[model samples]
Target: MRFGPRLLMALGAAASLLAACDSAPITGRSQMMLVSESEERQMGLQAYQQVLSKEALSHDAQVTALVDKIGRRIAAAAERPPGELWRAPRFRWEFKTVDNKEPNAFCLPGGKVVVYTGILPITRTEAGLAVVVGHEVAHALARHGAERMSDQMVAQVGATAAGVALAATVGGSNRRYVPMMMAALGAGATVGYLLPMSRAQESEADRIGLVLMALAGYDPREAIGVWERMRAANTGKHTAEWLSTHPADSTRLADIRHWLPEAMRYYRPRD
Candidate 1:
């Protein structure tokens, strides 16, 4: 079962409810999450299947070879979930490229990955590709999507229950309800998802991705160059769908600087 301490703490103060908490790995901070490992695994697997079924796989041999080469290396370094799940040994991992023009890529909850060819020119090298792969893979290993959904669950349940509690303690009038609900929506977005995940999650990804790349024997520093190219590619606008979801490129790049010393400890320079 999952748990959220902040919500529980509020209840404890207001109505005497018990609270529990857990730390997010690497970052090591207690967070309000209540999603199970099994539930997250199911979501990842189902999402992977859906993406594969809906998207057209690319037949380009060059792209296929590049992805295969880089993907295996990154996966070998990623010693979590998708790897640890090798317990009963039922599923196989596959990497495929899709023939889309969008400069985008993602790794679903399972080990399923989709790389769009349009991003190739920006990546431009084996090391550059490793940087992209490592970050996306980090997202999956951290169970970010599950964290996102679990956050939604907490807000939905907490607000409904909390509002009524407040009404019982204070008053059951709609005057209090309207302003409270609107405030919850705005605050929930900033505190719930945006502020929580936006800064912290990107930092986590940078830390994990660098270690993964280092273990994979790509110069972990290549990630810096890759992001530089990524920024340049965007030209006039630094804001894009990828930037918004992942975090500001500047923030992420600065974070990369901070993690380099730690990541280098694991880096095995290529022979």
Candidate 2:
């Protein structure tokens, strides 16, 4: 049998390593924060400006009201940033309805958000809209972007360390690992910019989002219908994939169901 002391020491060191990571405000779970807050906000601002300049926005009275109604609720309900570095000073929570048929939406750092007009029909109702906005806001509040960056950094560091160790042992270098530099860049985009973060992040968003919608005077039950409608609307070649950047629709819907009970705990209907 392996020695108990050695095993315990290993566990202790791992726990200590994890302690160095930052913790999110609401979940209070330690997270790997590879990028600073200012840089995140900077990218968010520039990206938002680029999107607005390039895309045509819809001026439908109903759409604007719906987006603003839900956005205000989610932003207000979300937990304030836990640390001093991420103050909500920059948050204005603007929601613009862009004329795109992509059935997509996003929240930038500092609370800038936009919904594509194509998503409106899928949303169907204000509460349904809340479900989408709340989920996006929850993503920001949890700082999933920075955590994803940290994950990429860790992966690269591991690759480089392994490459050095192999070179030391075999008295040779592995050129095959050279492509790994691209993998790191791809992984950073995959996790931080182009895709979602861990299962924990997704789960947390569902839980917190449900509560945010409820507090905003929206019916959280509408979330189920919202996703169902979204699933029905996607007639793309791969109706199998909801969006390239998000969790698989069925998996994400299931996760929402699993966390419904917990999310309800914080639900407070608006007066």
Candidate 3:
């Protein structure tokens, strides 16, 4: 019996996926990572340059210094043991504060961290700032961006193969149904798989971030308050949790509380 083209395509995709499996740091969650670290870092570097070119860097010396200080501590915590979880790759860490008013921050691959000045008001204090920075750093440490890229690639390939198979099965008589089926598949993948995976990664980042902040000698408990403030700030502006990429504020706070006990185990007040 000859194997059909669809079976061959599926088998190839499965093999590729299996070969690209990687485990995230601290959480030990398995991830699909078709993109190489070097490629990820290069993409990050290019994006970083583009962002820096377009966005104005913060001019407030004191605030900038404070962000740099907090970012350094978080980076150190990420590189060191227990938090490292394994012999992690060395990241050439750099932290810069952007002059934007959006309460946002992110850590690109290889540890390029950018904090918006707008988030400073929400972060409130050093420990509070650590909560935000630590969470962003956790995204980099866990390579979530690369995982997302891999997921998109696989989804696209699966969609293409599915479309081909559907077209062949329907031929001209039922060709009209093919596009509808493809759209349904896309929607199903986004709602059933990608969104949920993204939410899980967000929660995982929160947990890992709590540990990082604690290791950096910041009180992990501050994370709850910081998120509470965030909730207050965003008031009535969130999308439904199932449809959104990030968890709802309530779910996020609950997750942070749950992980706080474990994070506190790593805490040692900074002298």
| CA lDDT of each prediction against the hidden true structure | 0.63, 0.63, 0.78
What digit string (tens of lDDT, one per residue) describes model 1 on residues 1-271? 6559776556553342112244554556455434444544555566666567888888999889989889887876675423342222122345779889888787655566679888888888898898888877776666665555544544555643643443352233223232322232223454435455545666677777887788788888888888888878878875553435456677778888888987788777775
TM-score leader: 3
Model 2 spans with C-alpha error above 4 angstroms: 1-20, 25-28, 79-90, 156-200, 235-245
After superposition, candidate 1 runs with Cα above 4 Å error: 1-20, 80-92, 159-196, 240-243
lDDT for each residue of candidate 2 in 18-37, tens digit (9 for 90 to 100): 54377764456777654456
TM-scores for every candidate against the unseen true structure: 0.72, 0.70, 0.85
What residue runs in model 3 are displaced by over 4 Å at the alpha carbon? 1-6, 159-192
Per-residue lDDT of 173 in model 2 = 32
- Candidate 1 achieves a global lDDT of 0.63
User: Which of candidates 1 and 2 reaches a greater TM-score?
Assistant: 1
Clashing pairs in 1: 2-34
lDDT of 1 at 229: 80
Worst 10 residues of 1 by lDDT: 82-91
Per-candidate Cα RMSD to the true structure, in Å, reads: 9.0, 8.5, 7.7
Q: By the TM-score metric, which is better: model 1 or model 3? A: 3
Best-to-worst lDDT order: 3, 1, 2
Local error of candidate 1 at residue 169 (angstroms): 28
